[model samples]
Target: MAIHRSDSGRAPDTRELAKLARSARQGDTEAFLELIESLKGALYRTARTILRNDEDCADALQDTIVGAYQAIRSLREPAHVQTWLYRILINACNTILQKRQRQSLPGTLPEPAADSPVYQDVELREAIDRLEEPLRLVVVLVYLEDMRIADAAAILGISEGAAKMRLKRSKAQLRSWLAPADMGRERSS
Candidate 1:
């Protein structure tokens, strides 16, 4: 399937989503699997960016897929499936964060696999992890995932202005976090 760019001018096409939603709502297992296949990478990346741990990210993605499948019938607008799935993923991440916060183990969490390319640049990843959850979510969805600001706002349950504001702040924070000597290398080069 060809991927059409989103409004942000980077994301892929969401046009086929309506058919996937219809089949999923009808309890078509193959269709549901197709839906998952289309979204799983983005969902996992979003979760990983937010949670910063492989186990938590995997758990969040799993929960999101299950929740999406179960809740497909309640979705009124089939064309908005991408946003709907993102919302579920964000919710699942938030739930996991809240649980981690309550357990007081947030900071102690370890990074994911060293072999993964995502871990290649430790300083950048560390900088991203230091951001507040809200800003981090916005950065991941918009910059990394290439989602449009309006669609991200919808998925994040925030106003468009709020999404833009968050994106600005996230960029500023990333800049600030990278200001230290070693960390500054990435941006300068």
Candidate 2:
């Protein structure tokens, strides 16, 4: 059975997830360790989005593990584990941000996701970095990670309407920043 089944796969194996979540809750360290693999990429992407530094993303990931471990027992369902994990990750990122703010460091571009050509563009990454925190986060969760808007809103602890509003605003901002020449091309076409 696939670990992180995507939207189009046959129904996910709930029994496998239940066993994993149960083991993790029962102090099985290895099961807990294995469960993290499904989330590592998305976690890295979101952390990178928020911190824009590889080291900071690593720190945030570490914090996320610790926080998730401490709180996993409270989680009520295995099916929503990824969403629950994302909420923990966002908290960890916020903690790292607080530390960075106190130290007064300039943000830098993180290594982009290796799987996507779109992430390869330095200018696009720079444009994303210029967005406000809420808008940037919405873009990362929705556009970059291909998560549902509802999932993004849940992970961000916001209403769905609020998430939609941020996405709408961010789209306008990104259009202005990344595609100035497209306007002329559109008219000509």
Each candidate: what lDDT? 0.79, 0.79
Query: Per-residue lDDT of 1-189 in model 2, one digit per residue for the tens?
Result: 337646642223446656777788888777777678656777888888787777888988998898888987887887777788889899988988787677775675435533333376777887887898899999988887777899899999999999999999998998888877778988988
Over the stretch 1-189, how does candidate 1's per-residue lDDT look in tens digits? 433434544444566768877877888877778877867778887887778778898899989988988888898988898999988888899899889888876457555433334444788776777788788888878877878899889988999999999988988888877777676588788
User: In candidate 2, what residue range of length 10 has the lowest lDDT sum?
Assistant: 109-118
Instruction: Give model 1 RMSD, 1 decimal.
Output: 4.9
Worst 10 residues of 1 by lDDT: 111-120
